[model samples]
Target chain A: MTQISLAKCKVDQLVKLCEEFGNQEGELINVLHKAQELVGYLPREVQEVIARQLNIPVSKVYGVVTFYSFFTMTPKGEHPISVCMGTACYVRGAEKVLDEFKRVLKINVGETTPDGKFSLTSLRCVGACGLAPVVLIGEKVYGRVTPGEVEKILKEFN
Target chain B: MENNITLKIDNREISVPKGTTILEAARELGIDIPTLCYMNLKDLCIKNAPASCRICVVEVEGRKNLAPSCATRCENNMVVRTNTMRVLNARRVVLELMLSDHPSDCLVCAKSGNCELQDTAIKLGIREIPFAGEKSEFKVDLSPSIRRDASKCIYCRRCEMMCNDVQTVGALGAVNRGFSSVVMPAFDEALIDSECTFCGQCVAVCPVGALTELSHTNRLINDLANPSKTVIVQTAPAVRAALGEEFGLPAGTSVTGKMVAALRQLGFAKVFDTDFAADLTIMEEGTELLGRLNAFLNGDKEVKLPIITSCCPGWVNFFEKQFPDLLDRPSSARSPQQMFGAIAKTYWAEKMGIKREDLIVVSVMPCLAKKFESERDEFKTNGDPDVNYSISTRELAALIKETNINFMQLPDEDFDAPLGESTGAAVIFGASGGVMEAALRTAYEIQTGKTLENVDFEGVRGIENLKEATIDVDGFELKVAVAHSLGTARKLMNELRAGTCKYHAIEVMACPGGCIGGGGQPFHHGDSARIKARAKALYTEDAEKSFRKSHENPYIVSLYEEFLGKPMSERAHHLLHTCYFNRGKEIIEQ
Candidate 1:
């Protein structure tokens, strides 16, 4: 049996989240979506809690988290930046735009800055191929973004 | 039969049953289809044809492109071209892509000669990889029994299927996406950190160098070479039936004599058989079973029903982690390997007048878990392991070859005396239901004090995951269930938990076909027939024995009369009996 975590409050929340889904293994994705929303990220500890609650192995939960593009293990910064690497965006110089964001932010893709104010990540298709080379910062989207505009985009977050 | 589908492969017509895949149909037609990630242990309910590798793509006539024969169901009047130029080109291109990211260290790979990937490459005649790109790099994860190198994995998912589906351990699964995707435990932790039972089924089915045993050959060799040490080796019952396969002997061929000769040639002072201890185990375990049966008959509520066998180290580890609450339900008798080691360290050493420190006892087992079992703290005495260490049947073969011992030509020799003498009952312990059958031969006679007319309990035999039989022994219908894989064992355990199991006893073997199909045995390449063959070999050896009962073994009778005093005696408990640990809480510590 899975012992309750020492951090009782958050673990209670995780247990509650799993109970909400009736602890069905088929609801792993839905539970994961809500759990990620609640916890901000799916760390190994959180995954173990969910695994115990759902009566599944931690490896299965981790496999699912690692398989999907949206699910992430690390916490996102307040000003999380995502550059689309979709085929359409790539055709429209998204690589250059992504590199410019990395350069200005001084953080690699999937990494956060030392100050933790900004995190960089790459996305497949934001479903905004019409707005090629799109970059998003916290809900705000920048379309037709040029490498030259990367500095201005960071200024808005600042 | 009426719904049989007709398909033509290479213009040869063939009719197959419905739901038969194109790959099976093609193979039936004497066409060998090159495949990756398409393993099918038909009778065992283990399959990995995820169609991810796509190496078995065939040109299905009228289709726009090629179709994966492994996943595609053969249709009526379907025309398939397996060796078409287009199919060949597609297959080679897929191979090149896999090889591009794969490490080119075939020479040093543990699976170099026997790797399915290498064989497939050679079969396809792939010369050079045209497409080179970044490879997935993962830190090597080494457990006591298995080593995992994600970089060498070709995404075949065979190990994943074996670990998750076949064994139901769920210690491994595919993680990440696209090229970064690789199979591993959560957080890619070392295998020991996960709930891995060290069953090594993953290692057994791994087609490449991604999964291999953690070889301890060098340590064993050094111990053998030490002049000051008196080295003795005990071979497991299952080893003789399968060790010949590594030297090109057909599967299931009994090489006991030759194996003994080879061991002797390799400088071991004495070569013993674990079967002797297996016979001793039967004497002890059989008595324990009868005690429980009598207690239940007397309305003792505390006596747990359906006492499970504890001879398999893998099964022992599984229950310790997954079913800790039922730890007392299993027999406390140590496995034959450990029992042999304990007796060798205590009784044999005492008789020989050799200090225990100078005596080195090694086990040659057909299991990887036995390697882990020997080093366990519970199996140790005053910081010294009862069994100093153990090597797999594969490792023993390697040692024999390295020592220049001709295994095939060597004359068959009998096992040494005192600790090596065993009966037919012990010999059959190599098979899945063999232990139960062996125990019946003794338990029945001991309880009734009558001669057992026929020792063969054929009802307990077969390779099915779970089997049940009832024996009417003097009005006591002893219901026994034999379960050989953890997946199947889980079902029986669930029955016990639900209060639905009425069995008086159950035998559990973690590997598919008991020890004969153990993870450390010569690789069967997912062919279960070889496992059946090995089991048959053990049966043949059993039939050849004069004494067919454990209680009748002269050596066991003497051991009890002299040292043990009787079954379940204090001295017997000190050496032959062991306890189970609750590993259920261990996995969560991390």
Candidate 2:
């Protein structure tokens, strides 16, 4: 993953987000959430800014960011793709569907395409068990996702 | 009486404090409980009782499961069984499961004989790990002062606590989760690249082979074997108090004479004392303090007050990284280890007719940061370090044993002349408040020009993390503060940064109880009494000396007269004084 420099980020906005939470260490998760929303991901430079504002160590901020699955250190593409790897989805061949997405997009899990169009990731239990194999792109959930439909899913993003 | 609670352990009745943990109460009763992830240094206010390691679990009456004695608080009528059959089985299973994933390369490990895990395994009589599983492996991380082997880590988090909570360094933390979890620096940055100050407190607390000092004994051995080099060794003040522990002697036994004899046996050309350089440090540092004080009194607004001692390399790295804006506030005097190296390679080498390149200066210090300090670019000449390398007291002890020299059987011998003689003021530099007191002894007499009948400044002594004292020198009140451990140093530095500091001088040491509790000293195993004992030994040595002030050392006076004109002179400044850098700029402002 390429390192996103702080020069490219809206540094002022990051400080404003920390000030929004009164710069308290207790509000770290909330600050990280807002930071990810502002910069699309929590990079090293962004976490450093938040840590400085919160009067804590950057290592601690990074530790918290890595602990929870919601926070991402690398930037997601314009359209982020997540394949559900829940037990129900796995029983219905979600692995094959994920593999199809990997082959079609030329990118592996936790990575983005070079064209900045799509990124792929996997999650456990998206709570759409009735749909068995499930896949989510942004806010749109495609139930009963098949390995063959992986191409169709990419076509819509394109 | 109301605060006291009665409790029973293995049918023995005992009364304890209301909030006392089962571990402490059981210890009072002479119950030996095996623990892995529990550490408590009460004197320094450092405690790491994560209870993640279930080896300390014990049976409790009317409880559903075994309770972790290290964290479980005692209550009235509570009955605990520390060595019950069920508890033993549970502990054995926990140990087996932990050993299942842990690497079993104990023989070649750096911490093999001294490892607490090995001792516990022996005590438990564990023949083999019944559980078999895939072990987690990781590449070893090496730094100038410390080595981290995550594969040997038991997810104890003792290092994590010492780094983040106690030292406030925040270099190591618990990352990832479960079987894949390991304590590491942020973003997996190397320790040298991270916020680590190379204090080595983490290594001091580690129970296994996970964290250990980066050994330089092998290099020292090779250097000694080379007949072309005139190898000289300098022993720091703290080494005398603690080196005895490596042998059969008690923690606080002063083995200065025997240590010099052992160094001679190790084939070192000259066995000098860093205490001599410590006396010279006072000459340089004391003059700098007086100059700063005089300037500050004359209303020279640019001069920084409360000149902090720069002898501790760990504390120097700390301020440079954490409080970079106040970098100029610290004294520019080089540490005794570096001063000895610089002077040995120059004045001493020239006097002995040995070339600088051929004269190798090695220091035995009670600090890991000394190793890092010896390698700093500014301390080097044309790419050759002033001090070739530094070995810890533990490393020196290992080298003695490795050389087949029986330390206990060695005769007590005096150090070599010229660079071996030192005053009592220099010997106390091992303890936390020793520097401040030593400076006061000289600074008071110099500032007042009166005969000081009472040389002892008893106020700035002891094992407290922070201590403050005010001395009236010629009716001019001189305020001073002494702080040990980076945690307390942070508190003092934060005060200085905020402009609320009222001290004229402050001495800060990175390790608890100063160099006596240094990271490279023999492990105290969370025993605060051992630290106090070391400090007492230093004070006792000081009381018995003829010259109690740094300015009174005859050799120091002659060296200044023959070579350097005076303290703070151009020659003295060039050889003894050094500067600080702003290491926080890249991370904080980039």
Candidate 3:
């Protein structure tokens, strides 16, 4: 089932965006990037619309979306939290920092808070290996984050 | 002068044309190299050499690592060892890793004996799996015609290539990432919910037990055991051509008489032929084509040209899902399987003084889609299906084996009278361009007031993807086309969609070589030669028939006179014709 009723205006905007890309199948990933930006996140309805506009199978659209971890089918929270799991961060105890965030947020990785205020995700190499075990909330970054500093980091977002 | 590449394989020198893979070069030298995730149906222009499965790894003299023989091109003077210790160890390790992630249920697996993975395991002399880990598990998707067991999938991607690239159905794709990756429908939906045409090409190409036909042999056995019900069976023309392969008989060997005898021994009350209904199909479809052509000639702008054949259920589902707008362009005549079911359940049932519910009609087809076709709601009345069950040629062969009947030793026996009788045109329905040729043989004679001495329409009789020809029907130039496989069909459909198609009639078969290369036929393992052989067998049978045209079948003529007034009559339309649905709308609405 469609996870959300994508607004009619948003649907029109998606179609317009696809038309701008010439609706070529080769531009699928590019179209999907713009679609995700417009729709906040790629839901079933959004993917279906993009597939119809591009004249390809919805399964193919879903395949491309699922292949990359950067693309998400579910909506991200307003204050998104990303835990860097690069080699430097993992060696510096990023798993403990991630576990602390999961405990305090009461949500697993790639999940949003019940109030939809914060979403937790683990990404690879944000190019800040010097600040190992880094945790970023929205635009603010906390370098060399420890397990105890997770709640304080959440308080700043609040 | 052709540029050739010289290669040394197992100390044997051989020269092959440029761009030939090491696998092909080795094969040329009669060196059998094991491979998986590599398929080449050259005749259909379909090849899936992803090199995902490293089972075909070989030792190259200069390379640091073992190269996949299936993907590596033969280099001039390049030394290759197919059976070195290093190569054997790497191959075994690769297979062990695959087995660690795959379920060990081969004993009860549908493709137990026929699985390529299992064969490779034995060929490599693998006794124990040295590696064990968590096996990926996914819910089995059981569609009407095929079964999908994702747990058994080894990520070969052969099914993906067949579904998307070859058939252009787009029902399956490689989804997710890493260990959880699988070839499945979008959103992990069941195949029935997706745009799957039930072509079963995915099942045909799968090297493991991940994909297989949803068999009806068990239910058929139950029906045969039920004494209260009189079970009658009809075998499709293509089944006779390829069924012998299941019993170790060579490809292209027609075992029609032996097959009939086996079915009789299997305790069926009557063993009929689907070719009878194929003849009936030509009578209705040929007449419909003539009517539309004549109407178009008389300045009727509404008449749709290029009337596509509706015999292949896989092709029917393809148009319904992909080309819904051109629904009116296809002929309305039901497939031969459905036509036979309708006749058997109505005319024959009543004549035998048997109630419809008491009479069971089973079809032995060389197709997987016919199983899905038989289950369609349109082919049913008051919850009772016209055909009680549909089984494949492989299933019949299995039944003959399960019953301990020596298929090779069986005596030659003819089909039962009346319903069993058919014409040459009907038998040719097994091949790709056959329906178009059969219809032309009858339509040419019926349109002009001249006898068709030359029944063979050579232009439409081949394995070409898209074939076109023009015939002189009196003074009129009648244009026609034939296409096999959905990818080829899509090209023609796109032409019609663009309003550029000029043919008056077109025929499309979903499989590569029509029913002879059907997904439910004996597994060719991506060999185009086997498919060619099966097609040759069908043509041989067609040549041997006494009556070459559908109209020449006396039983069909008598049936029209006694039961159904004539072709396209009200009664005939109700039973012999059907309508199309916009499955695209259904999917979108859902």
TM-scores of the candidates in the order shown: 0.95, 0.96, 0.96
The TM-score obtained by model 1 is: 0.95
Residue-level lDDT of model 1, residues B232-341, one tens digit each, is 99999999999999999888899999999998888889999999999999999999999999999999999888888999999998998888888989999999999998
State which candidate, 2 or 3, has the greater lDDT: 3
Most lDDT-accurate candidate? 3
lDDT of 1: 0.89
C-alpha lDDT of residue B40 in model 1: 74
**DockQ of candidate 2 against the true complex:** 0.39
Clash pairs of candidate 2? none
What TM-score does chain A of each model score against the native chain A?
0.80, 0.79, 0.87
Candidate 2 retains true contacts at a fraction of 0.37
| Docking quality (DockQ) of candidate 3 | 0.42
Tens-digit lDDT string for candidate 1 (A1-158): 33424366778888898999999999999999998998888887788888878988888999999888788887889898989999999999999999998888888887888888998999889999999989889999989999999998788767
Q: Which of the predicted structures, 1 or 2, would earn the higher TM-score when compared with the native?
A: 2
